[model samples]
Target: METKREKFYMMNSMLCLLKVVEGKRTTVEMRDEKEVTGVIKHVDGYMNISMEDVVFKSLTGKKKFDKFFVNGKTIRYVHIPDEINMKSAMEAKLKEMCTYTASMRVRQEIKDQAWAKLKQKERRAKAEIKKERK
Candidate 1:
């Protein structure tokens, strides 16, 4: 069975990989078939990110944003920049993340996850009450 610790490690690996791309011009292919190129300004452990000087392109045309935020779930593939040495960068980032404090977005993601669990509990309680009544 996959333990929670293992899952957490996997998630951290992804976060570290992305951290190495910080301040670099990178391209991200989103799930909706749109593509964005920007200088990644900030990235959290949850992969929630803010980018600056963004250029978004899709089949229709293109758009620009002074800044943009992307939810990690919507990202399909991240194109690592050509000049980056992946193995070294990943090793360095992993070390950094081990001692890193949670960013604002990561803190929010934690809150949101907790809220979702509470909602699920509420739903189950309601179902149990209904079952007793019936």
Candidate 2:
């Protein structure tokens, strides 16, 4: 038997980075040219991240915070260490992306079917009313 190879693309790089760097020191650069270094505390599916023991850094100086939450939309870059192994992270990310895609496809299919059924019912109701009027 022959099998075909499928091409997989990274859907959310931030989610992958969050998975690989959780509990590890990370440096996040914002679009405004500010940087924050901390240990990742949590990450949501939206890529919003929370960090513990954060140090906000800029050309001016550095400020410390016990915890911080950064909006995903504001992130410019997330620096990951070269020492961390990427093979496992890539595998996990692929699985996550596949699951998400599958679910979305299923939902869309259900919605299309439901809409078609609704239209059919409306047509039937109109036919019944026309017959009564005759």
The candidate that achieves the highest TM-score relative to the unseen native structure: 1
Runs of candidate 2 with Cα error greater than 4 angstroms are 1-15, 22-24, 28-35, 41-52, 57-61, 66-84
Q: For candidate 2, write residues 1-134 as lDDT tens digits.
A: 11122122124343665666778888999988999999997766666789999999988999999999999889998888777767777677768767977997899999999999999999999999999999
> Ten residues in a row with the worst lDDT in model 1?
1-10
lDDT of 1: 0.82
What does candidate 1's lDDT look like per residue over 40-129, in tens digits? 987765677789999999999999999999988899999999899988988876655444434645888999999999999999999999
Give the whole-model CA lDDT for all candidates, comma-separated. Answer: 0.82, 0.78
| Candidate 1 clashes between residue pairs 3 or more apart in a chain or in different chains | none
- In model 2, state the lDDT of residue 72: 82
> Candidate 1 deviates by what RMSD?
12.0
Question: Where does candidate 2 clash, by residue pair?
Answer: none
Off by over 4 Å in 1: 1-11, 99-134
